[model samples]
Target: MTSHAATPTDAEAIPNLNTRNVALDRVRTFLTLVVLLHHAVIPYTYFGQTDAKSWIGFDAIILATDSFFMAMFFFLSGLFVWPSLADKEAEKFLRDRLLRLALPFALAALTVIPIAYFAIALRRSPGTTFAVFWWKTITVGPWPSGPVWFAWVLLAFDLTASVLYRVSPNLVDPINRLSLRGCGRPTDFFIFLLVMTAMLYIPMRIYFGPGRWFEFGPFSVQASRVLLYPAYFMIGVGVGAANLHRGLLSMDGRLAKNSWVWAVAALAPYCLLWALIFVKRGMLENPVWLPAWYEASYGFFFSAFSAATLFAILGYFLRFKRSGRSMLDRMQAEAYGMFLVHYPIVLWLQYWLFDFEMPAIAKATVVFVLTVVSSWAVTGILRKIPGAARVL
Candidate 1:
């Protein structure tokens, strides 16, 4: 969700490129809503349910969202990176990224994350004071970054892209060429993405397992998909390197026309993933350490599903939402800020509803609606502070 705003100089350097892509803006805002929905329903899923009521439907929803949303976030974040780098001095680019990404990540890790996680701590020990819990979290151990981990990781990727840009501006030229070809044949790009992600994700998943995360203080990342994310980011950089309008995301492109095909492609691998999950749970007895073969198979389907879903979602937006001001357009300016602040609202709502007797679906619906409205309102208010709009 990096800003797509371009300077006058950028318009000169990249001719025919619009300052903003309404479709992609809508896509990013939609993803923010997806993130909200993911968190809201997770507590009702069979795997993560902490409530008295659990629903299998929520398990399906979690499965789909968990598979691709964050990786797609990285891809969307990367789409504007190369252009930004090319348009500004290296120092200026890095400075802007630090202010936009790193600063928000730091503030959220220190304040937002602790407040959100305090709900969990309170569940464990009702008498735990916020000050004591916050101190223990920061000083002692296990300071979870929660969802804001994306911000810091994106900062790292942006910094890396800057260094790579300095080394060779043409480093991603091959990807740019591929993107041009993908204008008419998006399957090629999808195939390349699937292969790249599989190579990066499958082996690491086998080695580290799906649940293993590399954590240090408030900085944590899923070990299995660390390389996978950067791969997507770099691909995004390549696509936006040059001739962005005439490439894979072109409004007149086949990618938009064949959106349904990509949707089918996404569905196939997603179902395969569920089959593997069933085999692991029912046949393999859900072992603590899944076999390498299971992990490999699962990893392949996961990668395929993720890549195909990225295309499906992007294609749908490009095809049907290329113009006009929708609700997503209205939310675009506030999406990133909402993402940063929603965790606390979601966690607190879940905690408060823990004692309620409502059905799982009803409770999840309430949480999702309230989190969206509350987070959007909070972000709007925060943006009103002087100099806050620059960061938020």
Candidate 2:
């Protein structure tokens, strides 16, 4: 849920960010923390009701966060791709991506993911050895990437965009033009994104049925929303390709001026999503496969809410783009590292807390606060190692 800079090597430090997007960086950092909060509260949600106590509020949080966070992550990541590709050679770009993305993904898949999943393994088989579980997981069975799946997927998108850039640097010029037109009318972009994502997503959602995943070895992604993320990513590439300061995300633009309206637009579809959930659970009794009409309705609401919230968040941040000295700026450099390393810390904390006799809200709060601090502290230490800052 965070954007990365250039990769570091043993002799180098973190990439020197001479030109920065403070608003986008803050937004990305906020989303990284939101990712932590999402994981922390999942156990208390209805779908992931692993805790002794559950909360309706956490269900709301899960529903909203799950609907948009990962896609927003892809969008944020894609924002910088066009420029990066322009600035660097294809070989250097690919190498930097491999080091920054694939390296962390590979290391985390082998180390952090096993440790995190061990908590679940223990729950399933209390006496299971970590070594045995790790072996079986890597070789014989399902190996969930945890949240680090975003890294690999983003790298793939970057590579794809890179190739497309070579084919035509102006490939997304039309989208950029639309973004320019959308500055005063953000809903135009929202509708375009909604229609595009719904078209790419709804049929797949109905066909794959939401819970299914496409998995190969340590790689996996939600089957239903696979195309949705790419659509968001490409949109980002288009908007960021040219006139970033004058396009839809301009600080002085109408999108920022009308942030409140975007928030309301976001809320309407969010409420509609809840209503559809209600219908599915209450009226239809939560059938395994809902009718096509219900699935289409759910997809429409999902896409609408997602696009609206994205604009709302971006607009709100753009409105405050010149605000001095935000706290999120401090962690912006380390946000990607925090994201990469936080999963096991959070999962372990949840596992330890699962047996405690406490309310879900209190437990989730403690886990979230502690996870942010621990993850931040751990990333700080890791970045201190030579060349670690580059990749982390």
Candidate 3:
């Protein structure tokens, strides 16, 4: 997430060489790669349901990734914000954030997103020109931002946090205290997060319903989960406020010690979610307006699985913090760039592979592998340009 390395405009909170959490860096890189994988296999999943080849296993993966990845990304992105704000003036922080987040988001929204969707647009208008499609997307209608939506949303959160930090530096201190208390008993933190997320998320989800998007041209977010993301981001800020090393994420802390327990916690909710899915499809018959009770129950499972998996991932990464060199290290610097550019690559690859008669597993595997390699290579080349590393 934080990349652990600072640019001229941005500062690293932890200065000591020994204090850097390489595990988090690795986790961030892994999440970026997972983005590629998620998009690659989506065409073969029931949700996307685009390609002829569909896999039940991919449905499972898509369910899990859809539930957790972006939320975890927000959490990780928030980890460094409090510290970064502490070290810079408000004006400088805004400038740095603009450069780091907004510039790339703008470029991708205007360029990369249109190119990716053109493939989809061409399906309906078989002979549409690239120029015509691009113009129509920007000027006339539906300009989907795709994955770059995350970048803009994160920028908004960072800006909001800066304002909150200015109002009261100790606003998140209570959360910091709780994070400290959870060091030797992470179940407490897990329970707290689950309760908080459910309270914020479930009611909105019920009101808005799933599949609703807050779309306005290139900018859009899931209408229901708008509040949910900020809660996770602020919690991240709280956890990293102070005493990061001795907090719940400490290498020797109970969170890391009982990673297996957290994994089980995650699994229980995952199973519950699938059961609900079965009920929806088989018994409930996929009603337009799901019953309030059913929605609430599904929301509970979704929140539980999401919160548990966050802990599970963090705990596992912390447990293996000192496991020597990792493949994640190689792509660490390019993770952000890869995320920004990867949607187009993955979508185009799926489009190209749409006509193939290959099995779902083989197609997904090929698309995912090639997307990772191609995105990684492109990011590597992009970073070589003078000053590109600062933003990418």
Candidate 4:
């Protein structure tokens, strides 16, 4: 919550920044944190069971986070790209992106990920076998359990965005010129996204099936996590097209000026989210009332509500600057690396904590915090290590 330093003193010095990227980054952090919460606390539906849980009451809640994170991350990528495309030559941009994103992915896959499996094993009472886990980690490539796969998806998105930038020289001008003029209102934007995405993804699920393709060897399931997750990424593009940021910020800036009112309004969206989850959990105990329509509604509401709530909350925070600018700078500086490394630590922590008889939610919360803090701590410690600081 604490910010360390200001990003920039004046808007003029920074070129072409609209309210959208600001809103999206804040929203991205929140969704990512929520995702950490979901992963840290998977449903009792499967881990040790023989069959998958059909109801997906608990699983459904997490599903929302997965797609939401995807949508928001890609959106942010696109939003940020407007500048990159406009600013950099295509070859230079692609070179930096590949060096920074893809290379790290390969390195993380080879190094950081192996560290994760070993970390989890060492944390074990008997431990993960050195020979078994080492070979598995290396020969098998990245798995779902680690966060490394995200790096791959990120590379994909970056490559896609860079290509879009290239094509933009010819095609984007006719379309993108509108951003110079400005975009439509936020409400109109939200409804547009909701309708468009529902029209887009729902039928795909109905026809193509939800199971993943373009897999990593036997880990076919990970294909969805890598590629299929981009619906949110496209949604990110949609939010940009809608010009939702400035309007939301204009509204949020006003409300944030009145802290009490803004805080209360911020809580409103969450009340419905929690209520829906609570009711769904209890109802699923009995199958008689289940309906196919309800499943669709779940996805619809989850997608819609998450997008709206994220922007609203982000608009609220960024509208008002807290004094702790340095904290924000430090956290933001560290957050990228933190995200890169956190999940594997969380996975290891799961191995340690999985047997505990705690509530699903509570256990997840604990692991999430531990992983986040540990990632921060690790990054900080690594920052001090000889030569490691440069790569980090």
Candidate 5:
């Protein structure tokens, strides 16, 4: 839908776009914690149960987090790209992206990922040495990137956006206009996002079957979500193109006021996803190849739940915690570093805890808390090193 340019009143109604958005920083910090929690509880979950103890609650948590967090991270990462591009030369932006994303991704793939997955290898073959395992992982096969995949993928998106900007700076003006309309009617933006993601996601999920990944050494991504992630990223680029505060994300906007509505919207599709899970397990008997209809249904519900959850989380922060000086604010600086470094801490903690006879909840709680504290502490220490802040 077409809309007029942002008026002075619209700009005056919210915080300056040029300034920091405390709420989004907090949201990013919260997502970092979610990443930690997702990994922390994976060992205890029913589906991914690597430990003797398993919990249904963890399965639920995994289902919800897996459906949306990474995509939302891409969206959030894209949010400031337009402004950043405007402020810097294309070459400078690429260089900064390489330093911030590619370098860390390379380092983590070489060191952090190997170390993290070594715990699993150790569990499988107690006699295996880290040196041997690392060699095989690097030279022979199956070099999983772990969470650091986000860094490189975001860098790719950044590169693509830079080229697109060079082609035409107003490439995303339509979405920006849509975002402006979303200030009062967020449902419009939500629907647009839902439809776009579903269009991009469903057919790919049916064709690729969700379990397939495209991998090359440390670079790998889920096949079904490859297009989906870029869509979210571009939408974020659009929203941040201009008049960010005067658009959908305005603190004084209706999206913030109607946070509970999005919560409700998220719940319905989430429940539908669970229902589809039951259908897959019970009726379909977890077939090697799911029916096309089942995959389509699952994909739609997945996309819907993801879109709704994004709004729910963003709205909650924009409405209630926009100005807070909480733990999130304190951890904001270290959060990205924590995300980069937490995987090894989590896996190693889980590995050590594996032999301990504890309930799943207790083990998960211990793993999550220790991982947070350890990662935060480690990131803080690393940031003190000369020149590390630029990369971390």
Candidate 6:
């Protein structure tokens, strides 16, 4: 068996993740925080939250910020995976990633499946009551929401990669200038991105159909979300392995160097995206544009805007240099656990605080803040347990 070798720079030593890579750690922490933010803002969108004086206004497409986590998490996960994997032979790499992704996934699913059983039980009425809902939930009932599907899909992807590795490891590898010795150009990479995206999404929409617009909980189209979101992850892999960090770094003091400038210039595109989305949403609801092609196109354009805007935001923020690797370290330690566990915590708090008289926006804001603080706190607490650190 040919053992995998490390990246040439480290000469095969895995950097103690805890000691190094503050930026990456912070990215994980930040993404986790935003994910909670995204989920917490639900319920108000669809369920129409109750407030102090009880004003009920609905949320629009901006609720799609949830996918921003989709984008970030996949990208960051891909960022670390490539270098880490290169150190091992494909067989060992598959085994390692499987254990890392699959164990947590199975444990999380099994653990939460029961809790979801109970939660759905709590929400139901007597006729088709607690036992009925619980049975369905444990079997096929609702309540397995946010972060739930990620584990399942990630495991599936890992398994797929394993099969592909055995058959054609080179075909499975992300196309990269660094690995290919600089053969692929930027235009080629962009086309690769577009092709992967088109392959994943266009077919996904055809097969799975447009996902139900969920304002709360964690249900998504299981059909192909498993494969689709990984496109972004693979794109990130190409970017990182192609060694584009210097180019990203040197893009300083440009128009994009200031976030506000991006904001202003992006205003027109943002408005156009919103307008098109509104038209699409209106048409979709009216039954005129609810077909597969329309749904697929809708997801495509919105994502295009999201990606463009994300680039602008990252381009601006990356120029920033922050002090205090220490804060990042502490947050980073708690991050993975926080990401895995925070949704329920946030939901439970939302339920407990439901009786409190507050505006919907205010309640969402409070939940957002509470979710971050409590998740961070609980992650820290969990890590103090002897065995917890390993899983987290």
Highest lDDT against the true fold, candidate: 5
Candidate 4 Cα RMSD after full superposition onto the native fold (Å): 7.3
- The residue-level lDDT of candidate 3 at 61 comes to 90
Greater-lDDT candidate between 2 and 6:
2
For each candidate, the alpha-carbon lDDT, in order, equals 0.84, 0.82, 0.82, 0.50, 0.85, 0.51
Assess every candidate by TM-score.
0.95, 0.95, 0.96, 0.68, 0.95, 0.74
Q: For model 4, how does the per-residue alpha-carbon lDDT over 274-327 read when each residue is reduced to its tens digit?
A: 555566667665343445554455445545655554454544565544333434
Give Cα distance to truth, residue 188, candidate 6, Å.
7.5
Judge candidate 3 against the unseen true structure and give its global Cα lDDT, from 0 to 1: 0.82
**Per-residue lDDT of candidate 6, residues 352-389 (tens digit):** 66667677788777878888888788878877888767
Pairs of colliding residues, candidate 5: none
**Per-residue lDDT of model 2, residues 88-115, tens digit only:** 8899989998998899989998998888
Candidates in order: C-alpha RMSD to true structure: 4.1, 3.6, 3.7, 7.3, 6.4, 7.5
Per-residue alpha-carbon lDDT of candidate 1 for residues 268-351, written as tens digits (9 for 90 to 100):
888988999899889999899999999999999999999999999999999999887699888877888888898889889999
Model 1 RMSD in angstroms? 4.1
* Candidate 3 backbone collisions, by pair: none
The TM-score of candidate 2 is 0.95
State the lDDT of candidate 3 residue by residue for 215-270, as single tens digits.
88877888878899899989988998888889988888999888888888899889
Stronger candidate by lDDT (3 vs 4): 3
Ten-residue region with minimum lDDT total, candidate 4:
1-10
Give the better candidate number (1 or 5) by lDDT: 5
Q: Tens digit of lDDT per residue, candidate 5, span 1-392? A: 00000000000011244576778878888888888888888878767757889989999998998898877887887887887787788888888888888898899989998998999898899999999999999999889888788777888898999999989999999999999999999999999999999999999999999888898998888888899999998998899889888899999999999999999999999999999999888988889999899999999999999999999999999999998378888987788888888888988898998999999999999999999999999999999999998876
The whole-model C-alpha lDDT of candidate 5 against the native structure comes to 0.85
| Residue 146 lDDT, candidate 5, scale 0-100 | 83
